[model samples]
Structure formats: structure tokens, C-alpha cells
Target chain A: MTTTALKARKEFGKTLASDIAHRLRNEIVTCQLKPNESLKFDALRLSFGASFTTLREALTLLAAEGLVVAEEQRGYKVAPVTLEDLHDLTHARILIEVDLMRRSIEKGDDDWEIRVISSLHRLARIEERAPEDYASNTEWKAAHRQFHEALVSASGSPTLLAVRNSLFDRAERYRNLSAMFRPHPRDKAGEHRALMQAAIGRNADQACNLIASHIQTTSNNVAKYASGVISAG
Target chain B: MTTTALKARKEFGKTLASDIAHRLRNEIVTCQLKPNESLKFDALRLSFGASFTTLREALTLLAAEGLVVAEEQRGYKVAPVTLEDLHDLTHARILIEVDLMRRSIEKGDDDWEIRVISSLHRLARIEERAPEDYASNTEWKAAHRQFHEALVSASGSPTLLAVRNSLFDRAERYRNLSAMFRPHPRDKAGEHRALMQAAIGRNADQACNLIASHIQTTSNNVAKYASGVISAG
Candidate 1:
């Protein structure tokens, strides 16, 4: 094979795998593929317009991010979203993220605070409604994700942020799915404002405590909502 | 495929994937693949004597646990080991683990204390050599991992335990790779004994501090050793 041909083929494979990866990540994160739904290679090949190898490569990336589960023979599935998982995920999130916020408050500069404030502004403006159901709006989902990511981006520890992001991604599916069954009335905007106020003021203890309570409140709310459905079913 | 034929095929796939998963996991944890080694698919398939489907499935499982990284076109690679990563991983471990030890002290049963003591006794029995050349000793590695796991198994949080196990698996490769560097005089067994004593005596603060220092000391030693080689390279 010519060098040019080999290089072209490599580029093609790279683009194909990444394209497939982006589509699969969005599908799992947004629940286009329902929880515990099996992913078949043959069907995915036709749908994704890729070969078995390309599709598996994409799935491997998703699996690394905890957005998908791969079973030996059963094939890949959207990772099961459970109340217990939500509770644990949130607890771990608080454990890592609150510390991150504390560190960020200690080390974050004006630019970091600016980023946090901007993300909060965006979140406050977003409409929070059911993501599905035609007339429903949940631009809040995207805004909420941005706000949380911004909170830790200043943590300055790449591994901490990376693990935090993974936990957040996994928690998102459960959060959206259970949102329809349960609506939170408490002022999320207020919580964000207080969190920002504390962090901007460089009050690490208050910021840490607020973040912990904020996470705990969401965990309790989601767990109650999800368990209610299981019993009802 | 016919129904019976389909069922048989699935069984075969399941066994093959699972077997590869088990072997691959051990190979990784034991540092057989080495840190940052390229995992070309064809080579892995040949090494494992498995089909592409089976190998992909196994790699997916490892990827989920953060033991390996998947590249878009290049294929999988053993996750890299670095001092920065070790520092972050160690800090995260200490945070979760110290909290866990405290919880175990507060909530642990007599059996829990006994198990901790037993693990300490076993760990104390193992000879501490220069890990530089001892990285390949299978028996020593197994005993070391078991000792650490047994300490926190009484924490009563499966999620926490699972995350801890995952971090430890990733750190082992760095530990092995860094082992080939200079030796530092560290109290290899005394630290474990002190931690165990404090825990059994219900000295939460002492136990927590000991564990934290214990982990950081090793991190510092490994960092000192790796920096020279890493910079030279």
C-alpha cells in the first residue's frame, strides 16, 4: 500500500470512530437509548453506517465514561439508572466536588469567578421543563450541566475534574428520567446564587458546606422520586 | 441464525468475552501490559486466542473501570502512569479512605476489627524488599492488594469500595513502573500495623492521620524516583 493511501485510510477511520462516539455519547446521555436498552452490533452498523470495528470503538469510549455498560454476550446497554446509584453517585460527587469547590475558592482568580458567575447567569435564564413532551422545555438541563462543570473547572486538579465529570454524566440520565415523575419546587436559582456568593467571597468553608447541602438535597429528592416509581410499578 | 444456533453462539460469545475479561484484568493489575503500553487489537487477539468480538467486549469492561484508555483510531492503550496522577489518585484515595476508616471505627463490629488485625498480621509477615526489582513477584503483589482491601471492606459502602478498587488497580501500574527506580527507606509494614492498632482502639483521628501520611509518604517516594527517569526520557 502507498503511504498516502495508508494515511488517508487512517484519517477515515479516525473520523468515523469519533463521529460514532459523539452520536453514541449524546444518545446515552439524553436517553435516546433508554436505560438498560441493549445495543446490537448489526442494527447499530446499519444505523451508524459503520463497520463492527468502528461501532465497537465508539462503544468502548462510552463505556470508559460510564455512560454505557458492556455485557459479554448481551452486548452494550445504556447503564441502568437506579435510585441507589443516584444516591451513591451524589454522595461521591459531594465528596469530591465540595472539596474541589473549596480548593477552587482558595486558588481561583477573578477569571474563575467570572466563569462561575456567567454559568450561573445562563442557568438562571434557562427554562426548566420536561425535556420530552412537545411543548415542554428543559433548556435548564444544558444550563445546569454547564453551571456544575464551571464550578469545578477551577479546581486545578485534572484527575479530580475528570472523575467529577464522569460522575456528573452518569447522574444526569437518572436526573432527567426521574424529573418527569418528580418536580422540585425549591429555588435552584437561589441555591446557585448563594453558592456563587460564597465562592466569590472566597469563603471556602461556607462554599464547601453549601455545595454539600446542595448535593445532598438533590440526592434525597431524586432517590425519593425514583423509589416511588419502582414501588408503584 | 436458527434459535438453537443463536443460543449456542451467544453462550460461546459470553464465555469467550468473560474469560478474556478475567485474564485481561489480571494482566493489567499485575502490570503485565506495563504502563502506557500500546494495546494493538490484532496483537491482543493473538495473545488471548480470541475473536475480535470477544476481545472488544473484554476491553470494554476494562475501559469502564478506567484501567485502559481507548483512542479513536489508534486502538486501546494501558492508561498512563505519572507522578501527578499518583498524587491526585492518592489524595482522592486518602479522602475517601480516611472517611471510610472513621466510619468503620464508629460502625465496625468486633469482627471488623478482628479482620483488620488479621490483615495487618499477614501484611506484617511479608518481607519488604526494594520494590525496584520485586515488582514482578506475584505472591507479594497479591498479599499487598489483599491487605489494603481488607482494611476498608468493613466500610459498608459497596460504591465507595468499588471506586477505591478501581483507583488502586490503576495505581498499581505506576507503582510497578516506578519500582524500577531508586529505593527509599520507608517503614513498609510498620505503617500498616500502626493504622490497624489505631483503628482497633477506635482512635479515629489517629487512624485517619496515619493512613493519610502512609499514602502520601509512598506517593512522595514514588514521585522522587519517577521524576529522574521521566525527565531523562
Candidate 2:
């Protein structure tokens, strides 16, 4: 191939790989792909209409995000969810995310507040259903992520946000598992509204407290339910 | 190729890629590769005796670790070191590593204590010279890293340790920069000995404080010296 065509083709490959990674990430996070499931390339290639190289690249991205596990001399598997994993993720989030939220409250401008209000509205409008029902509800999932991210949008530290985001994405599987076994519907809207008020009101302590509880509650529910279904150690 | 030959070739490629990745990681972290310097494929291929495919695979791995930045169609560069990045990494280490050290102290058994003492001894035996000298001193670097990791090896949470490890590594580049511009050599050994005493003594609060200060001191020194060197934004 000519240099120009080769460069263009390489760019196309990068975009295609990223697109496939996003698709696979959503599936894995929502439990549609399921935990500890082997991700055979042939099946994934057929499903995504991607080449082997593209599929491998996509899996590499997911592996970096901790959503997929790459084994030496073996293929990839969806990362397993365990009670210990959930607790670790929860503790990291409480420490990092709460600090981010406090910083956001201290540093945020009017635009950040506006984003918090609007994202919350978007999420509040979506129906918060059970895990099985919401598994395919990408819109609600996106809105929920936006709302949480918007709260800390002005933390002004890209590294902190990236760390917070990875922990958030890794914990998502457990949230689905938690919802799957929840005996009663959580008043997520109410909780989010409280968090939003505290954040915009500049009550950093209260905002941090609410987010910690919000994280801890999901963690508790997941451990209570998933302990029996997955590895305890 | 036969199926077995193909499988063997694939396994060989994986190992070669990982080896290249490690080599590149050490160079980038130690700043031998230099921050924001272009990593052209042809030069890297010649230098590492790697094929284009193998080099790309290695770059992908380094990208996952935040040591390499891949530009679409253009190739890669060593990840940049900015004051903001240093602060973000240092803040992360303070919160996460201190927490890990605290937990390791609480949960660590006799082996953890022995490892900490031995690693400290190993580190102290080596010369903690200037950055330019220590840049080539992989032994001292390895011992230093082992000493810190050993202090938190029993945090009982793989996820937490993984996060801590990443933060620690990303901060390494800045530590080298800090040492490069130091007006006087720091008593890192003394600080580390104190930290070890606090950790093995089960004084979580003291250990955490020592680590936070050690991390903060490096961060402040780097900011003071390198403020005029790199990107401010």
C-alpha cells in the first residue's frame, strides 16, 4: 500500500478498535456478557464483524479498564466479581470520589452547577428499574454516569477523574448484581437529589457524606446478595 | 503454517511483545526516553530488534500503564510530566498508598514485617545518589520500589494495591525530576527507616503521616524546581 493509504487504513483500524471496545465494555458492564465468561475471538469476531486484530485490540483496551482479563497463552475472560473486589472498589471510590466531589464544590463554577442540575434531571427522568430490566437500558446507564460525573466535573484534575472513572466502571457490575437481588427498589432519585443539593449548596462535608453512603449502600447490598453466587475469597 | 506452528508463533509473539513493553516501560519511567519525545516505529524497531507488529503490541501495553501516549496514525511518545500531573499523582499516592500502608500494618503478619526490614536494609546498602547517577542504578530503584511495596503488601486487597502501584510508578518520573533539582540530597533512607519503624510497630497513624510527608516533599520539591521546565497548564 502507498504511505497515504496505509496511514488512512491505520487510522480506520484505531477507530474501529475503539468502537468495538466500547460495545464490549457496555455488554460486560451490564452483565450481558456475564462474569468469568471466556471471550472467544471467533465468536466475538462473528458477533462484532471485526477482524482478529481488531478484536484483540478491543480486548486489550477492556483489559486496561479491568473489565477483561488477559491470560498468558490463553484468551480473554470477563473479569469476575467477588465480594472482596466490591469492597476494594467501594473503599477506593469513597476516598477518591468523595475528595473529587469536595474539590468540585470548592472549584466549580456556574457551568459545573448547571451541569449537575441538568444531568440529575436527565437521570431522574429515566425509570430506575431492576437490573434485568435495565440491563439493556443504555440511556439510563449513560444518564446515571453523566449525573455522577457532572457532580465532580470541576475537580480540575484529569488524573483524579480518570482514576475515579475506572473505579466507577469496575464497580458497575456489582451494582447490577446488587440490583438483581435487591428486595426493595432503592430511592435512587431521592438519594441523587440530596447529593446534588448538598453539592450545589457548597456543603462539601454533606456532599461527601452522601456519596460515601451512596457507594457504601450499593456495596453492602452487593455483598449481601453476591456472596453466595461468586467467590468469597 | 501448521496449526501447532501457528500457535507456537503466536505464543512467541506474546512473550516478545511483553519483553519489549518492559524495556520501554523502564526507559520511559526513568526518563531515558525523555518526556513527550516522539517514539517513531522505525527507530524503536531497530533499537529493540522487534518487528513492527511486536513493537505495536508493546506500545499498546505501555499505553495501558500511562507510560506511553499513542497518537492516531502518527505513532507514540513518552508520556509527559507536568506539575499538575505530579500533584495529581502525589495526591493519589498520599490517599491510597497511605491507606494501603495503614491497612498492611493492621493486617500484616510476621512475613510482612521480615520483608519490610529486609527490603529496607537492601535499599539502605545502595547509594541514593543524584537523579542522573541513579537513573542507571536499576538495583537501587528496584530495592526502593520493593521496600515501599513490601510495606503495603498485606493490604489484603489486590485492587487497592494495583491502584497504588500505578500511582507509585507514574510518580517515579517526577521523583527523578525532584532529585535532579534538589539543593541538597534528601534523607530518604532516614525517612524510610522511620516509616518502617512506624509500620512494624503497628503505629498506623505515624506510618501514614510519614508516607504522606515523603510523598508531599517530593511533590513540593519537583514543583519548586521544575515549575519553569515543563508545561504549566
lDDT for each residue of candidate 2 in A86-192, tens digit (9 for 90 to 100): 77788888988888998999999999999999999877767644443543367887888999999999998777787788888888877776666666655577889
Measured with DockQ on alpha carbons, how good is candidate 2? Answer: 0.46
Q: Candidate 1's residue-wise lDDT over B22-119, tens digit each?
A: 67877886677776788887899788777876687677668767777888556788776666677778878887888677777888887887788776
By summed lDDT, which 10 consecutive residues of candidate 2 chain B come out lowest?
B127-136
TM-score of the second chain of model 2 compared to its true counterpart: 0.87
The regions of model 2 sitting more than 4 angstroms off are A1-14, A128-136, A181-184, B1-14, B128-136, B180-184
Tell me, by TM-score, which candidate is best: 2
CA shift of B54, model 1, Å: 4.2
- Docking quality of model 2: it rates as acceptable
Give each model a TM-score. Answer: 0.80, 0.89
Candidate 1 Cα outliers beyond 4 Å, as residue runs: A1-71, A74-78, A127-138, A183-185, A231-233, B1-34, B51-67, B128-136, B183-185, B231-233
lDDT measured at residue A185 in model 2 versus the true structure, 0 to 100: 51
